[model samples]
Target: MSEHIIVRVAGVVEETAHVRTLRLEKLDGAPFTRFRSGAHIDVVGPTGVLRQYSLASSPLESSSITIAVKLEPEGRGGSAAMHEVKVGDHLKIGKPRNLLSIADDADQHLLVAGGIGVTPLLAMAYELYTWGADFELHYFTRSREEMAFAELLSERVEFRDRVHLHVGVPRDQQPEILEGIAGRLTSASHVYTCGPVGFMDQVRAVLAPTVGDDHVHIEHFEAAEIDTSGDSTFTVELDTGESYEVPADKSILAVLEENGIEVFKSCEEGVCGSCVSGLLEGTAEHRDNCLTESDRADQIALCVSRAASDRLVIELY
Candidate 1:
């Protein structure tokens, strides 16, 4: 029942320095389906790398889908390959999946985006604007030159003044800005954030005292790097009464896939919770940034997390 499909790259637009907007056209005969704001699609590439990029375009326009990718110098081949993609290139894409979605009952929305993390937030801004909903977008970057979609975002009526730009400042200088604007966020207003790990961490630290845990939503383009160097092997038990040994150097998801378990996953770095499953037993050494501490005790993300014990069991739904 997976909605995964292969699509052709229809076009590419240079959005800014080190950033390109990829336009994908569906090959299915049923035409393109709609995705809500804050939804992301996984693109499978060569070398078995599965990367997740948020859809930046509005869902109302279903003829095509767009994702903004920022080239990282130290990144693995994913971003580099995406940057070199040409028209007519075929890519495997998963259906739009959303973990950070806009709440319908929210009275107002506060969106904070950093660098390329602005991709999903931009879609949310569009959704709010189309509905004439109350919202504010705070975008932060190292410099104006690095910001994407400057022209389009600035031209929109709802985003022009409400969009606050923060650039060229030390880390200490950012706290005041975050506290000044985001201090009033309440249960009635949900705060959504996406960006580099440090950026998201700073935002979380600033708002942790003011906003409740349920009111904050975040998405990461890459998984958090964790030190998995250890000497151990764990047993992963599937729901079908099958078990496999996962080496310490590899992830549980990798072992399962090698054994033909066919689990749905994207963003193997653990940023996306697509590989999360119920933990039948054993303590998990949670290294992912996607789930909270409380959530880790009950469920585990097989992509990045490993077991703290010799034997761990998981039930895939």
Candidate 2:
């Protein structure tokens, strides 16, 4: 497991009925590490369940870090514990990591966010505004009440004119709106999107044809549901030459930890890259949402990915 930083909840803002933004300061009073926009940290909740949340604060602010959380009653209890957190309570958090980041070389940047997915894009807008970049943010929600950081996005940001809010838009009307947005983009326009899987899939399907696959970037909060019925047993070899058999029912992470091999892991769903390790040999059936094609050439996410070959050799810290 990775060593966690202890942070005190300095303040909390109720953004919506089910969402809250938490301001975290180091318990030891040291300055927090500066991270790029769209970075996320692994937070261990009071229930000891770990969850990854995107940083909503400006990257320029190093004094403290902030994250917005939307309470998910159907979730595995992490958000519930976060809702129970209060100011002055200390919590354990991992260092910031980013899978979603701004594209600097684009002629124009288009950020599309849905529901709670606006958290990371809010940070990106802050950074882009500082750079005076050509960018626009489109936020969509079921209703105004469900939109997080409404005031900060519309009123506080310097690029408020570039922000567009689509509240209470019916599902049937969304495709036309998305198509209209896609029609205005040039070949040099780059898109970054984070939202529900279906929303993201639609965004990609609509925008990728205009901007091309290389220019369209996606960030997934959760991995898509994968069918593991066809999963087969495989062998994994550590750097130390120790071997383990990973059954079809169990993940590579479970096999390693069961044998008392500690690994740095957060989201077992493969949305977080904490369990990503170097691939020394063999082919990997990559199922992770975190790694790109180039990344898949040399790396493997141990949590959800499986071996395409009969055996795989991985390097661990």
Candidate 3:
């Protein structure tokens, strides 16, 4: 069951110049349930502006959920409102929902985090630390001051030793440090990356040769906006032999929702993988930022992506 609970901010920890961690406690006698490592919660702000933030705290801790927010100077009032939230002020929040998660069969894990993308990766790292799994975090940022959880992460000697911070310029220019972690890249490793578009692109380019295609996992906070300039209408065939017409201006997801098809979605810009559907036939003109090329052949993100062919068949799971 889903409950829109009013949660009060217990405390705030300023992790960096632009980042602050908010600790929340449910006030309506709702039980604080444990979530997966990469889970996120949607916060309803003062003006009812909804925004999602990844949980930074470990899932093992069920007392409260911690989310780190980075104030964006040009953001659309979401970050600014989050910054203004006081200690005693109540905020509406949804239950935790996980889009990215650790695969149980993954032998070795390579985590790449950039800027505030470290939020989700940090929780995953804590889970790996608890399980004593083979994992390494390659954290990249412009400088140490811009990154959050540096002190908290560094305090843990065991996880700190596994984390290699790459500051200043990009990793491509720093060959020595990249070489040190190069040996860890293998087919047995599951490489998970999260960050901005440019940062994720660079990491994908650098490790494409070593990690292969299918083993690399990724999560994005924002997706690149695409130009939907094409023909007006396309046909979508469901597994039940139902067909629907989707307009070029509208996404497949919107068309489905209009028809009362309940598919999960977060980050409508196509960064989150919540709205992914299985492609049965026809080529998909993938405009999403989440899945790789190989993943696109079999899977399609209903949001921000369209059909390349005149007719497409998909199985909605």
Per-model TM-score versus the true fold: 0.90, 0.94, 0.87
Error in Å for residue 277 of model 2: 1.8
Which scores better on lDDT, 1 or 2? 2
Minimal lDDT window, size 10, model 1: 222-231
- The parts of candidate 1 lying over 4 Å away from their true place are 1-3, 27-30, 45-49
Question: Residue 111 of model 1: what lDDT?
Answer: 94
Displacement of residue 279 (Cα, Å) in model 1 is 1.7
Off by over 4 Å in 2: none
RMSD of 2: 1.8
Cα lDDT for residue 258, candidate 1: 93
Provide C-alpha RMSD values for all models, in order: 2.4, 1.8, 2.7
What C-alpha lDDT does candidate 3 achieve relative to the native structure? Answer: 0.81
Give the top-scoring candidate (TM-score). Answer: 2
Residue 287 in model 1: lDDT: 77
lDDT of 2 by residue, 49-112 (tens): 9889999999988889999988999999899899989999999999889998988889898999
Ranking by TM-score: 2, 1, 3
- Candidate 3 residues 1-317, lDDT tens each? 13578898988988888999998888864658878888778788776777788898888877778898889888788888888888888998887877678867777888888889988888898898888899999888889789799887788754678888888866567445554565766766677778887776676666656766666667777768677666468999898898999997888999999999888776677776678899999988898877777778899999878888998999987
